[model samples]
Target chain A: MKELIEKYREIGFKLTPQRLAILRFLKGNTSHPTAENIYRQIKEVYPTVSFATVYNTLQALVDRGEVTEVTIDSQKRHFDPYPKPHHHIICIECNKIGDVFKDYSDALKLPKNILKEFKPVRNHINFYGICRECQKIGGIKYGNMSKSRAGCREF
Target chain B: MKELIEKYREIGFKLTPQRLAILRFLKGNTSHPTAENIYRQIKEVYPTVSFATVYNTLQALVDRGEVTEVTIDSQKRHFDPYPKPHHHIICIECNKIGDVFKDYSDALKLPKNILKEFKPVRNHINFYGICRECQKIGGIKYGNMSKSRAGCREF
Candidate 1:
């Protein structure tokens, strides 16, 4: 933990008590938490924590490569601590994100035509699936369903 | 277009004017527009357009497998008229998303362990790169950089 603190200090992070609390919470977390998730967890310990502080600190960490944002869920941004390169698998039914550590860089070659227009940097693959729990529960709403059922009933 | 209407109606859609307008807008659109983007466009032709209407239409379309939600951006959901199964390439500098029509499914087999826990449904790959325009401009911020400038400056 000392090295983590020193690393942030070297990077000029203010490391306020709240920030420290956030760092502690995210240190080895693997849940792929959202901003609100982080705020709620931190609030349990620091009741006075503001959402802005959580957002700012999260943004700072993300900017410094300490956290990686998982774009698997369109509804909210999920943050993962940056340990190494990885991808994600999301449960379509429950929205649970699981880590995929195997690297597929060798197989992700871009088509020559697209390569001409854009110089490729990196890639992330989102594998959508039915988690065991969701499968067991027969969950089929697929959360993105529009709130109105005005005349649609097939789903 | 008549066939499209018949398709949705067969599945029990109401075929309201606003819903039809949104459907026509998305019939073959490839730009991967967000809800707000669609809302603005529809509002021009239908002054009475409501966000709820747009969102509801989108949700209904998504639920019925008529539209695919592109989860490439974390900020908001972008919808693609469910043309076919495909992938995407995003310009890191400008955040412009492009479609990749090729399929890589044959090579994306999951490791045995994960496959056992979750049944894979589909996969979408997001290729990050610098678009031609951004390259001409010497590239703007990559946007994912952690806020620290301590030892990381190469992004």
Candidate 2:
């Protein structure tokens, strides 16, 4: 956290109180929250904080390689704050995202055909799954957003 | 094309003039255009096609598994009309999307650890690269909208 604060100061990213709150929330956050999610959480303390501030801070983090924008969900974009490259699996029953930090770059070698046009770079894997809670709930629905995950533990 | 028309018609689709126009445009289109792109193309001909109609058709196609929505780009959703599951390579320099029709489901198998909390269902891979056009055009200045591919041609 201290290192990040220093880096943010060095980058001249005027770290406002709202930005500090955002940074603290994102410090070790593994929830892979959308912009609205972050804004809502921060609004509790920083009542004046807007989505614009959350988004701007996220954008700056992304530009600094301290965050990643995940596009798996169609409704909104999720932000992954972990700088280290990793894979994710989202519960099809809930919008819950779990990390799979293993490196699969070697196993992801492109097929002989695709090499003709593209010089393949890095890759990300989004595995769809049913979490333990959703599995216990017993429903045919996949990706249920209404279920509050309060107290639901993260892996 | 005739086969697809008959197939869709037999499946209870209305096959309206506008739907046919969209269908014909997307039949073998590898361009991976968004709904707005489809609307723009159809508007050039139909001129009266509404955005809602285009989105509705896209939603219907998605529901019927006639198209796969590509979320590799963060800015706008790109719809691919192909039914077959395949990977995609996007040029970092020009944003051109190329198809990779290889099956990597075997290699993409999740770790036994992740299997504890979530059930793995499907996987998709996105490879980033530099296309021929972007290489010649110097390069597209990177931006959040850098993924909107244009000027894609066969090498």
Candidate 3:
């Protein structure tokens, strides 16, 4: 925590009590929380923290490469404090995210046509699946319909 | 267009003219448009079309596995009409998304720990890099700072 404060101070980021609370909450956090998630947790202690403050602080962290914004979720942005490169798997049924540390760069070569158009860089994978609990509870619900009635049903 | 209408009819998806317009816009579309993008384009032809109509139609398509929602952009959802399993590479500078068709499934094996917690299903990779245009325009700008001045700079 002290190191983080010093790092923020050296970076000229104005550190308020609320921002400190956010920083502490994010340190070593593996939940891959969203801005709203951080705000809800911070509000418990400060009771007066605004959502903007948390959002801005997180944005600053992402800008400085101190945190990574996980874009796997369609509805909201999830934040990762770990600086190392990694992949993620999300539960399609419950939106639960899990980290995958294995590197697959050796296997992810771009096709020749795409290579001609754009230079490749870092890559992250999003695995879509059901968690053990969700599997036990409901099993696979979508995409397993009779062809005659498949397209018409609403998910 | 007739084939698409026939497909929709066979699937029992309601075929209002407005819905047909949305379907027509998405057919063979590679641009990976957002809901707003589709709405704006459709509005030029049908001024009375509502955003909700477009959004609802998209949700229905995604539910039925007719379309894949591209979650690469943080601000809004982008829709890809192609149904084939593939990956995407996004330009961090311009947010231009390009499709990557090569299959990396052979190399993306999950670690035992993750496999134990979550059932393996499907996977998609999101590659982050500067596109050729952005590379020619500005080169890399973020994460290249002096240690003394790095942490303080805002992107």
Candidate 4:
């Protein structure tokens, strides 16, 4: 926590008590919480905390490349504190997101035409699937098994 | 045009004149326009067309899996008329999105733990890059060239 405070201080980010609380929440967080998610959690401790405070702090972090804005969810934007290149798979039914640490840069070659048009920087893969809980809740037993098996076969 | 009308009709989509016009504009369009983009274009023709009509038609098509709602651009949702599995590379500077039609399913093997937890169905790669035009406009010549060259070296 001291290192975090010092790091943000070195970066010249003002450390309000509320902002500190937010930084604490985001430290090593892997759940990929949204603005509202962070706001609700922080509001419990700081009852007077406004949503704008949380949103603006997050935006500041994203601008500095300290946090990555995950856009896999269509309804809302989720934030990841880790900005390092990685992948994410989202559960289509429950909207749950899981991190994928594997790298596939070698296999994701852009076509020659695209290579000529754009200078590619980084790539992220968004995988969509149904979680086991959702599959059970939706009573999709044998149907999903065959589909997932076929998907595995393709790999 | 006739085939598009027939296809939507065969799938039981109500073909209002406004909806038909929207369909005509979307057919074979690779631009990946947003709803507002479509609305603006449609408004030039049908001044009386409400935004709700365009939005609702899109929602219906999305519900039926005829259209894919692209959430890459955080500002607004872009719609892709083609529902076939594919990828996209977006220009970070201008937010211009381009299509990538290659299949990387084999390369994206999920971790054993994630595979166990989720029944994977499909995947899409979101590549971030700077287009040639943006690189020139931003005066970011040699800097991005090295970064992109380094990126390509990884592949």
Candidate 5:
């Protein structure tokens, strides 16, 4: 935590108390919290904290490569602190996200045709399935997968 | 078009005029338009059309496996009518999405560790980069990459 504070300070990221709290919350966060989630958590400590502060801090952090924005969830953006290339697996039932550490760089060879049209910068794979608790709760209705998976209509 | 009409009708999908208009708009659409985009186009022909009608028709079509909701865009859902196992490449500048017809299923083998926890259902890969027009327009600002690629902090 001290390292992060010093690093941000060196890079001109103003360590406002609320931003500090947000940075603290996101430092090693793995739950992939949304901006509102971060705001709510920060609001508990600083009752007067504004959403703009939370959003601004997030944007600044994103700008400085301090945080990663996970876009698997369509409704809202989720934030991750780890600044490495990785994949994500989301629970179709509860929207819980888990990190996938496997490097599929070799496996994800784009077809010759696509490479011709798109100068592929990078790729992120979204794996969809059910989570353990949701499976136990019997909430995996056949037609009720989360909206994100609504895109995978071919399946 | 007649085949699609008969196909949906045979599967018990109601063929209201608005729904038909939506179906016609989406029948072979590759543009990956959002619901609002679709609604605006439909409203040009049927000015009295409501957003609820467009959303409801989308939901119904998704339920019936007639339309696929593409979730690469975090702000709004885009729809694809061709319900085949395909992928997409999106321009980070103008949000232009193109179809990728290559099959990568055989190559997407999950690691042994991830395979044990979650039942792998399906996979969608989003390829991000600048398009020809965006490149010609010189819109690739240092911080202008879309939020999805915001995960790739190094870029």
Candidate 6:
């Protein structure tokens, strides 16, 4: 964690208390929290942290390629700290996001016309699924695993 | 256009003036307008079109699956009226979106663990690229293809 702080300093990032707090919260976070969520979490410790500060720190981190933004939710943008190439599977029932660490580039071949027109840079896949909690709820509500599993389109 | 009204009506959708105007504008729209963008367009014709009406029509269309809500734009939700199964490639420079009719399900197969934990339903792929207009702008602004491509990575 201290090494990360040194890295931000080397990158000319100002080590403001608010920014440090934001960085600490995001360093190993997998929850993919929105800016509002980050602001709320940071406020618990640093009561004086402003929303603008949080946004600024996030912008800085994004610019540095240390974080990625997840737009799976329609309402607000969520931030991911991992710089690794991966995909996300979001539970349609709970809106919880889980990371899938695998490269599917082999499968994402662009169409001929698309390659002709615009040079494709990168691709993102969004998978919709039901989590364990939703599955448990299904068992209680529907009284059977077979019917609930049947309700889900593909096995 | 009459067919659209009757089709939505068959689904028990209320055809208010704003809803009808929105339906008319969106009947053949492929530009994928967001709710706010739709409200701005509708307000031009009917000054009384409230935000609520825009949201209500959007939610109604989404519920009926007449309009596909796209999350390509991280800032806001974009709507697609083309019920045909397709994907989108967004121009990172100009935010213009292009359609890709080909399916990449084979390439996007979820990992065994993800498939086991959550029942998979559907998937959407968003590809980032530079549009022709943006390509032209890129040529004028940067004078190098690599530099112009770097601009897209600014996000």
Q: lDDT tens digits, residues A1-155, model 6?
A: 78978898999998988888888888777778778889999999999889999898888888778898886866677889887878888767656677888888778888889877787888888888887767877734332332244334311
Alpha carbon deviation, residue B105, candidate 3 (Å): 0.7
Supply fnat for every model shown: 0.80, 0.66, 0.89, 0.83, 0.71, 0.80
TM-score of 6: 0.84
lDDT of 2: 0.79
lDDT of 4 by residue, A4-60 (tens): 899999998999999999998988787788898899999999999999999999999
lDDT of each residue in B1-155, candidate 2, tens digit only:
78978999987888988999999999878778888889999999899899999998998888788988887766678999877888888876666788888887877778888899887878888777766666666644757435454565421
How far does residue A113 in candidate 6 sit from its true spot (Å)?
Answer: 2.1
TM-scores of the models, in the order given:
0.88, 0.86, 0.88, 0.87, 0.86, 0.84
Tell me the DockQ of each model, to 2 decimals: 0.66, 0.63, 0.68, 0.66, 0.61, 0.64
Error of 4 at B130 (Å): 0.9
The stretch of ten residues in a row with the least summed lDDT in candidate 1 chain A is A146-155
Question: Candidate 4, overall lDDT?
Answer: 0.81
- Candidate 5 wrongly placed segments (more than 4 Å): A137-155, B137-155
lDDT of 2 at B25: 90
True lDDT of residue B10, candidate 2? 86
Error of model 2, residue B99, in angstroms: 1.3
lDDT of 4 by residue, B1-155 (tens): 89888999999999999999898888787777878889999998899999999999999888889889886966578889876777898877666678888888888899998998889989988888988777766754443332353222211
Q: lDDT: which is higher, 2 or 4?
A: 4
Docking class of 4: medium
lDDT of 3 by residue, A22-119 (tens): 98898877778878888999999999899988988998988878899898766678889877889888877666778899899988889988887678
Model 4 chain A weakest lDDT span, ten residues long? A146-155
Segments in model 6 whose C-alpha atoms lie over 4 Å from true places: A139-155, B139-155
Q: After superposition, how far is residue A155 of candidate 2 from its true place, in Å?
A: 14
For model 5, how does the per-residue alpha-carbon lDDT over B1-155 read when each residue is reduced to its tens digit? 79978998999888889988998888767677778888999998899999999999998888777787787766777778787878888776656677788778788887777777677778888888666655666744655454443323211
